[model samples]
Target chain A: MQIPKPYLLFLGDVRDALAVKMARGILTWRPEACVGQLRLDDQTPSLGIDDLPLEAGRERGAQTLVVGTANAGGKLPEHWVDTLEQAIELGYNVASGMHQRLAAIPRLADAAKRQGVKLFDIRHDAPALEVGNGKRRSGRRVLSVGLDCAVGKMFSALALEAELKSRGEKADFRATGQSGILIQGEGIAVDAVVADFISGAAEYISPANDADHWDLVEGQGSLFHPSYAGVSLGLLHGAQPDFLVMCHELGRPHVRHLPHIQLPSYAACVERNLANARTTNPDVVLAGFSINTSNVDEAQARAHLAEIEAEFGVPATDPVRFGVGPLIDHLIERTR
Target chain B: MQIPKPYLLFLGDVRDALAVKMARGILTWRPEACVGQLRLDDQTPSLGIDDLPLEAGRERGAQTLVVGTANAGGKLPEHWVDTLEQAIELGYNVASGMHQRLAAIPRLADAAKRQGVKLFDIRHDAPALEVGNGKRRSGRRVLSVGLDCAVGKMFSALALEAELKSRGEKADFRATGQSGILIQGEGIAVDAVVADFISGAAEYISPANDADHWDLVEGQGSLFHPSYAGVSLGLLHGAQPDFLVMCHELGRPHVRHLPHIQLPSYAACVERNLANARTTNPDVVLAGFSINTSNVDEAQARAHLAEIEAEFGVPATDPVRFGVGPLIDHLIERTR
Candidate 1:
């Protein structure tokens, strides 16, 4: 299904990392699906988007107004409700990727319902999942694992799936989180599953199929992320991938939010991911790397990519900028 | 709270491994609490318990008839309901640790309600758990790691806690599965928790408090089981244990049910558990081993225990038979 071009709204300061993360994910991966951005604070010189006032974006044919900033608690700020209400009143779908449910908020939900518009509270509506049976099927499985959560794992998996499909390859994008679920129209929200069955849910979606097919299973959480390591491990084991793509942002020094704790080296991170994956599937192989260069300049991004490729001996690319052509080629040849 | 003395029912072949397992666990850990066993078959010559007919156990003052055999799919067999109905009609509490809820069965539930007795569907009524924050609590954590599921991880943890308590030491039993939850009266059934929050549930129940106190956290699943590796890893991380106790049945050559999957040596299993545990808590150590010698003769059990102790250079004991005094003493002295 072709989702309408969204009017991405970042009400918080544009330079704030958490505030701009979701917006960056959209702009980088699905920029064509976005009409423009509406921000209250305008200090986002590096956002690299058509910045519009909310009314102007609607006038420009934005069908959905997406609240694109995430707070620490993922709650929708009270002040943003007026802007969301305005969008709903004008017959626009309201979408949010926060933990707080827009449908749970009486005012916003009521407004959307009254105006006959859809309310997309991405996290809250994820489907319940069953326990995994660990049955391996025919097709090759490729999973995007990241150094930390929200470091372009989903973007990379989706981008790689799109790249593969463009070349007439039979590939499926299996989402493990809400955003991927919204995009794919079908996928178990792995994180929403009861902890006992998270891996099972992952296994359920990406089942054993023919070798000609490829399942680009979206990754959730992270092996190193303090808050979500269990989900990361569950996804790793459940996916039981033949190929693993290491997704990384250019220069994240520490896990986001936990400032004092530093992230392990890139090599160490990849090694750790592979080792954990081996606990269940000893044959899991690292295919390549998908680097997120959203915050880096072109030259710097290229240099870092080259450095990572040389160090890890894997094809590395910024899926949004450089495209995942080399990585896709490598996967096709290796799996075949 | 003192639980009602249960009439353990092994309606399936009494010689079946799973049928005798629950009976063995209850008899070993809390023998005084069991009135007697009610088996449909009489071929269990090795089951060291007073075998009673269903009516006889109830007549001997049994308050509950516990359906003790766990089937492959955890579904209640159709044939057993008739006997259960008879027990319910006689006003005995019904308890089951199966995935199929005894309270959900129409006839049995109605009969139990009418008869004014409780139906304890142990796994179904496990408390809902919150996501784990992975916060290390004050007390030193001691977790039971197993070579396979049903290898007495829960029994060993409970036994150790009892031994410590009898010695006037402060120790808490933290249950992570249905059987333990049924006995403890209060515990988060970790396996029932949403996948993303399994570890968090472990953390929520075993908070950091006094350094001198100990939380003997019962483990679930197995690190080597293909279908349950995720849960095992989550528990390892969630427990964030300072100490680990390896639990293994004496004669199992491979993972139960899945043949050809050879069980790893005690050292290899302990090392693997420690390596996974070190992902979060770097200082986790294996304190000792809890060998399940129920299937072995007394001479064979003692010989195996001596061999393991010599090979690993650690204290080893069958917590049920010889008690966990040696392991507890070692843990107390080492931690002190």
Candidate 2:
């Protein structure tokens, strides 16, 4: 779904930095789309942008009010309904990344309807999709698969897009999750879709483009992750990536949420992903490694990267700490 | 969702045998549960059961009227509404395996509500599920995985369940699809569940039981099928089978519905399924091959089964044409 922008990011009394991750991502990557930040109180965390009132933000050309901060239960706080209704009354479309739907609240829904404004529920909003056809689409795709959840798959994909664009190559960052969708203003939350349509939604996310164009598809859960591997596999097949970049977090002891399950080795992760990806794109190949080296110091991170590159014979780098230049270079060289 | 037995199977003017597959499945596997049949017209294929009216079937102890036929688009035919309402008015819970919701039809929904009967859309009914925790639970489990869609995974699972029970072993067939759900009377259609809950629903389907008990979990979609691999993977992780049976149909040249995509080799399918299945149950092993030999002569089917058994060093049989005794023997021996 294409969320209207420029957006006034709503951080409703959220004190934790993690709660405002969606807002932070949008500001960091698409700062130009973010008109201003709107907070419920002074205690709320700042996105380092102007804390403009709804009227002020709308006057500044904010077309949408984005509820980017998540609450404890991912629900829209009852107290925040007044502010959302007022924003809708001001002729601004409202968007949310919360688990709950904004349209489900009668006050906000009625206000939006009266003002002819739209409510975009990023997690719940998706176009009707067909099952994955496994047809070979004409475009180069690079997907970031991980060894587990929250391994910087989205960050790596954004980096890949930025790097490709800097080199004057055609590239687009295709988001598959809530935060990424808010950042890019368009994407399907494949995880929230009905199970059978996972791959179909992924295919819709990155459709056929110019052969030289690259769609950097952000990945989700890992193949080794018992809870979410199905989503990962469906996305992998639908994307039909020409190149894959394995994303891993340094020093992860176990699979996320499940303490008893240990992470698979990098070799196992890469081999399995490639084997599954080959179902749609037979010529698919591993391009590089995108490591999350936040747990290690610069020297250790650099050394680890060097070791991985030497062992796997592919470029390795922390996309957040360093850059995705090496990965992009490898992708370009491999394609050539 | 527990569909109350005994069911009066509804075949709505469907002349094609394929359309009545669900009715046939229920009749074949759970004949005791099938009280009678109700057809709108004489042209509809019969299940060789008593053809009774709604009131007559209810009087005969049928608690549910199961719409077990599929129309061209899986929609409930507008003309079939009167029959469904009549069943509801006669105190029969209406259960449908159609893509459309039974509760969506106002006349049927109102009738069921007024009659205090339930409308169960088999493909849409699911309990709220948590994400699969990937924890080891008690009870031995066997899953039927396949090389492609409709390759007899459910039939193999049912056969395995039947064979195990015939040996006086404790076993239950866990259904994961529409037809399987109708036959078994309870299950979550994993494919129709929200993507995030596929595995969670699966775990719920076959919960912890006695250590000697076997939950013969029916599988869906092939890991190599582009449209459905995600559902397959999620189900695999959720089922956490200690042993797996590979289901394949002979003479199938390509993946179902996607003729352009060739099927993966038997070795590849087995290796991939085992590798993925190991994410949840690390000790998972291939117990046997369940081949659909309807396309071949008895001699050819027997010869192919023998060749497969010798190659894989696992029991192989056509569960339908031949018995699943060899497969069950292998399972029993391996577990011991």
Best by DockQ: 2
Model 1 ranges with Cα > 4 A deviation: A1-130, A259-262, A294-303, B1-28, B31-121, B124-129, B260-265, B293-307, B320-322
**Candidate 1 — number of clashing residue pairs?**
11
Name the 10 consecutive residues with the lowest summed lDDT in model 1 chain B. B1-10
Candidate 2: tens digits of C-alpha lDDT, residues B1-336: 799999999998988999898899999999999999998889888889999998899889999999988777888777788888878888999999888898888888888889898999989989888999899999999999999999899999998898999999999999999899999999999999889988898899999999999999999999999999999999999999999999999999899989989998889899999988988999999999999999999999999999998889999999888789999998899888
Error of 2 at B240 (Å): 0.4
Ten contiguous residues minimizing lDDT sum, candidate 2 chain B: B70-79
For model 2, the docking class works out as high
Pairs with backbone N, CA or C atoms under 3 Å apart (clashes), candidate 2: none
Angstrom error at residue A22, model 1:
6.6
Candidate 2 lDDT over A1-336, as tens digits, reads 799889999998988888888899999999999989988889888989999999999999999999888778878777888889888988999998888889998888888889998999988999999999999999899999999999999999999999899999999999999999999999999999999999999999999999999999999999998889999999999999998999999998899888999899989999999989999999999899999999989999999999999989999999888898888888888889
Q: On a 0 to 100 scale, what is the lDDT of residue A243 in model 2?
A: 89
